[model samples]
Target chain A: MPSLLHHPLDPASRIARLMLAEYGVPVDLEEIKPWLREAEFLEVNPAATVPVLIEGDVIVAIGPLASIHAIEDSYSPEAVAGLFPTDAAERAEMWRLFEWVAVKFNDEVTRYFIEEKIAKRDQRGSTPDTGVLRAAKANLHEHILYFNWLAATRRWLGGDTMSLADFALAAHISTLDYLGDIDWGTAADMRDWYSRIKSRPAFRTLLNDRVIALPPQKGYADLDF
Target chain B: MPSLLHHPLDPASRIARLMLAEYGVPVDLEEIKPWLREAEFLEVNPAATVPVLIEGDVIVAIGPLASIHAIEDSYSPEAVAGLFPTDAAERAEMWRLFEWVAVKFNDEVTRYFIEEKIAKRDQRGSTPDTGVLRAAKANLHEHILYFNWLAATRRWLGGDTMSLADFALAAHISTLDYLGDIDWGTAADMRDWYSRIKSRPAFRTLLNDRVIALPPQKGYADLDF
Candidate 1:
């Protein structure tokens, strides 16, 4: 059995969980606040980041990107579903969009939103700064507007076929949606896309994630909005 | 023939170049300053990132990671070399270390150093901030120390085989070295490892790369150092 060290709201962790569930691989989830840099977690990953996958004896996949790739390499070929596309060009596009969500969207939106909105309330016990939140919301609006057009144009985020790009984007958007940061009404196509993704079996684990003190916003677990 | 749009000092571009060269894939280099965000470049990659590999008609690999993966998937297996290790565990280790250099080190050292030292001087035409440079150097010291110990223990950064991890690391280190940022004397084993990489055939084109306005640091091209 594989055990995943992850945070409930971490986008990368969500992606990893979705990757596993989509491929029908069972995993034991061990929640950890990676920022805390616990001694045990640090031993497995010096970087102190989450989504570390511990599999068979002496086989550990540390960090988000590495762990995701590890799972894809192991069970993907024989699995009924794969997160990657079969075609070379489509696969390249899939990777390109994956980087967009992981690096660009992460820098511009997810990290900012988490720091200003989620981190203050949950971890630091500090007040959420409206000024920073405002700026982050503006960034989110820009990206969502772009995604709205993108979602309208394609069957999935990358192309006609669903890939890691879809799940990765959904992971980030889901986090923001949980915090009541997204304006679904304004994002028609993207909203439609999200609603479809929300109903997937892989997304069940994520939609059920609750932060105890900081509950999810309205319609987070709703199938249709 | 493949054409690569790259910036001489860009770590990701350097990594792609090294990957192609190691696999004996010749590419016509087209230098681009990504910060400019030219209309033409945006058409290919909306992110305006460098190291976009343009191959067969209609086949375009955008961004550094995507382009590297593109080259690896196409020319790798039987081209006398491959960037990935055959052993599953070793490959996992390679991806882990590759991410370390791509995400972690780039965030900590490369971006900060480039924004302060290289980008300030080259792109913005402004004086490099000594204070910011000082902080970046401190961060680099911590990472290099970690690499030094790891390099001393293994034949390569990702264990026994020379993998993408080595080139990814060399890409970033070479960039900093060109800008005269590294203290090679203190990084004994790492520097020794770098020296060996510097002599490789794939490293030749990188050594020959010259920016008209900016030359490399003292002993930058010298392998004996």
Candidate 2:
């Protein structure tokens, strides 16, 4: 079993956790404060981000993108079938969506929420900045509209089968969803898509994740959500 | 021949250009101002990022990550051999370095330089913030030290033969070098490694790049610094 150094609400960490669990790879989770730049954590990943996958004493990979490639390569391809689309074009689309959700979505929305809401709370940094949160929410609305279109049209976020693109997105959105920042009401197709994915067995662990003083929003763990 | 929608100094775009050229894949480059969010560019890449790869009449991939995968998959593996390593562990390390250079390094240093120096000039936004430039330079120093160590130890940035990790990093560092931010005197190993890479035939295109009102620093296009 690999040991994973992660933060409960970190979207990148959530993506790794979801991928590993989905592939039935058991991992031990060690929660860390990445902002603190703890020497132990920094030793494993000089970049100091997570979730870092470690096998025995050797650290394997860092961040969501590396973790995805690491997981696909290291794990049995047969077991991780649905994690990647088979068709050439679909796989290309999968990487594109994966890049968008991991980079653009996180940059415009999820990262701000985490830094303001979660990191501030943990480190006693400051009250969550209303101005920043407002801007992030506005950005979130645009992303949701785009995602809503994808959800309404594609069978899966990457097409045909649920892939890493779906997990990459779910991980980020779920964090925002937990923080009560998402207005699921306006995201009809995205909401419908979430309901289907939210009910999956791989989603079980994410539902049970509780951030010390910050409990998830009402109905966050519910299948009917 | 494919068409690459890119900007000269944009690190992501440069990475794509480097890879295509190194692999002998002829591509027609159409430079765009990504900050403009032009509808044509957005129609091709809704994320509105540069380095969008198009084949025939359809857009294939976006960003450095997608471009790397698309190139490897689409091109003959024999022609693109050195872009990836044969060893599994080395390949994993390649992705790790690729992720760090593309994401962490960009967020910390390169993007700030582009946003402040280039984008502001083009967008007619405002004068470059001295405070931001100071912080970015400080971050760049730290990154250069880390990269210097890697250059001193490894055969290449990602180990053994030159790989996409080297291109990913060179694309970024070269831009900052062009901006006259890099102190070549201080980064001995990195400078030596870069000198070797800079002299390659694939590097010729980058050497010839120029912005309207901005000429590169001394030795910017030189084979010998």
Candidate 3:
């Protein structure tokens, strides 16, 4: 069995887990406490980032693209619920949206939340900074607006089919929602899109995720907000 | 003719430019001063990022990966060049390294340089913080050491061939070198590797890059540095 080095709260890790679950691939989840600076974890990913996949002797480390590439190359079913688009133009669009979330959204929101909340708490006595959080919250609002525009125009972020782009974005947004950072009332189309995504069987595992003392927002597990 | 929305000094933009020149593709470069808040450019990329490629009606924006993917898929020669490895595992490794430099290195080092230098200069009367510059310089030294380790172990960052990994790294290093931020003396192996990359025909345009009042370092054009 492949061993996935990850943290439950990490969006990238969550996305990887969702992909594995979607594919019906069993993987051993080894939680990595990045703050602990574990040497073994560092060996797998020299950069010491999470969501490192260890498959026998070959170790695949990096973000969504690398993980998605590895999983798709090895286990993607012919036509049943694949995460990537088969058509050339659609595939390109899928990649674009995947990158938009992985880089832009991740940078503008997820990393800020981690750095401000988790990393701050881990480094004891340090509290999350209001300034950084303020910037992140503002940026997130703009990001949601962009998502609203996309969700309003297209069937999905990429196109007609569900792709890695949706999972990548939902992973980040879900994590933020866990912290009550998301304002679902802002975009009706996005709210409807989230409603559909939240109902996915693969997302159930994510809905149950808890971070001790930081219980998810009241309606986190509910299908309807 | 294709239009490229870019900031010439941006490492990612520079890399895209190099890749286009290397492939003999002609592009009309349009400078988008990100700080200027140009609505027209922002329409092309909501993220307000550079190196956006406009091919006919299709607007492909974001980082080097999107541009690289577009170039490889559309214009690459029948015989795959050493720039992007043909082997699956090797290609994955190259992509991983590319991500490291494009995202990690760019965030850690390049952003600091931009925040300290250009942004500060643009906001006249606001001096570049010496402390931030010092920290960025220190952090950059550590990054070079890591690069030295890679140079010592592999023929190229992705191993045995010049790949996108090399270009990704060189792109950032060249940008820093232009501002005299890199201390090439820190790693001989890294310097040697860079010397080879600098001599490539793809690199000539980068060497001639001028960023207004910030002339490149003395050795920027010297092939034997």
Best by DockQ: 1
How does the DockQ of candidate 3 come out?
0.35
**Per-model C-alpha lDDT, please?**
0.87, 0.86, 0.80
Best by TM-score: 1
Query: Residues B13-71, candidate 2, lDDT per residue (tens digit)?
Result: 98888878887889999999998888977888888788888989887887656777888
Give the CA lDDT, 0 to 100, for residue B113 in model 2: 98
Give the Cα error of residue A126 in candidate 1, in Å.
3.2
Where is model 2 more than 4 Å wrong at Cα? Answer: none
Q: How do the residues A4-29 of candidate 1 rate in per-residue lDDT, one tens digit apiece?
A: 98889999999999998888889999
**How good is model 2 by TM-score?**
0.96
Scoring each candidate complex against the real one, what DockQ results? 0.73, 0.63, 0.35
Candidate with better lDDT, 1 vs 3: 1
lDDT measured at residue B36 in model 2 versus the true structure, 0 to 100:
84
Q: How well is each residue in A1-225 modelled by candidate 2, as lDDT tens digits?
A: 998889988988988888888878888999998988889878778888887778998767776566777877777457437577777777888888999988888888998999899888766547999999999999999999999999999988977888889988999989999999889889989988898888888888999999888999997998887
Compose the digit string of candidate 1's lDDT tens values, residues B8-118: 989999999998888788988888888777898888898878789886556479997789889888889584548888787888888888888999899888998777765
